[model samples]
Target: MKHILLIPENEKPTLTAAIINTLLVSVLLIALFWISLNQIQMTLDFSFIGTYRIRLIKGFGMTVALGLIGFIISFFIGLLSALGQSCKILAVRYFCNLYVMLIRGTPLIMQIYLFFYILGTAWGIENRFVAGILILSLFEGAYIAEILRAGIQALDPEQMEAARAVGFTRKQTVRFVLLPQLIVLTVPSLTGQFASIIKDSSLLSMIAVIELTQTIREITATNFKLFEGYLFLGFLYLCLTLPITLLSKRLERRFRHEA
Candidate 1:
């Protein structure tokens, strides 16, 4: 008896479809963009890239600074919250659950207003940048906590056992073994949440924070160039988020290959 099977070089069905779809999408996007280019009104001074670009450049720097500080604080707080949720101590887990629920369930703009207006007002600290950063950090912390929690749970119990057997304390095991793997697994999710924070930073427009979106609106209002100013702001936002989105994809690919 003879039986034969032939497999294509790209044997995976998903991969083949993915390749075809990607090519189609690229062609379609190029065609669309070429057509759209003719319609874009550039009545504003295109030569004004330097002067008009300054606010966005500075705004992007401030936005990046905001993301960095907020992500750092949020991730740190998330780590502790994840640990609390995972702790054997019942009260710790209960309180941590409450913290996550409270933050995740609330409307972020309201939280930002209240935190900055009510709480911050009481302290006489009405700094928009500081207020924006803290509110975002608090909001993002909940989401990051859940991401880290899931990452930790995805690990094999044996990995923790192995670390424990290697004469490592609980702290050392988590620091050396768990945290590294958790970070690798959660990078994509964290990047998305980071982007969310940047987009949400637009809400700070309520308080007149001079971030990109707010500044652009102000410029457009003054110049009566709504579309142009907003188009510029939209580009600035793409600049902020596109790199992270691409980086996240690259990270996912690297980890997939490693795994």
Candidate 2:
């Protein structure tokens, strides 16, 4: 009798099998992590969480607020910059290109320090929160501009011709024909960028912004629960970003289906 394979090489896994395998891998990874922690004789005590819950909550709120405000401001900046890149005036196009290139090329930490300390002090911007929002917006706007520019460029040239043929004014064409498709194309990336904004907001802590990371740092400084504090910080960020990631995936699928 010929030996038979339990499953064919090219066969797709069943849902039950996939679930079982995922659970098995998860358990194995957890077990390995537990073993590594034991080997290092490190213990994580989260008992202080209850005592510092109010501060943590406040810090979490601050992070969310910064991300929301930064996203809104940066989105307009990006939109205008992207449009500027296509302008008839060479100066406008060059300025937008230089802005994107400078912001994108430099490290964000360096930009944060320079903006907050040098430009911010010279401009007499005393409030850390306001300065943090501006810095974050400036950094993330470069990335958003690139995303929007790519989406704009990806459209067929024939679409513009068709719109003009239909007697649509340039503004009307942009409002009706371009914006809708651009939104659909860029939604996934924009959602993902929001997740990035939340994480990047942590860097504002360096400038004494009282966001999530800064709060965790203060707690860790007093309590000396560095690992536990940062671990919980990661958990809190996951709470924010995981949903965004899921939403991005869902939108990508919907867009693909519509296409």
TM-score for each prediction?
Answer: 0.79, 0.92
Q: Model 1: clashing residue pairs?
A: none
Writing each residue's lDDT as its tens digit, candidate 2 over 89-188 gives 9999999999999999998999999999999999999899999999999999999999999999888788888999999999999998887888888999
lDDT of 1: 0.80
- What clash pairs does model 2 have? none
Model 2 earns a TM-score of 0.92
Write candidate 1's Cα lDDT for 1-259 as tens digits. Answer: 0111223476554655667667878999977866776677334444444666778677677777777888899998898999899789999999999999999999988888888889889988778888888888888899999999998888878888999899999899979988777778888888888887788778877777787777777777767767567767777788888998898888888887543
Q: Which one is best on TM-score? A: 2
The Cα error of candidate 1 at residue 138, in Å, is 0.6
lDDT of 2: 0.93
Worst 10 residues of 1 by lDDT: 1-10
Off by over 4 Å in 1: 1-49, 88-92, 166-172, 257-259
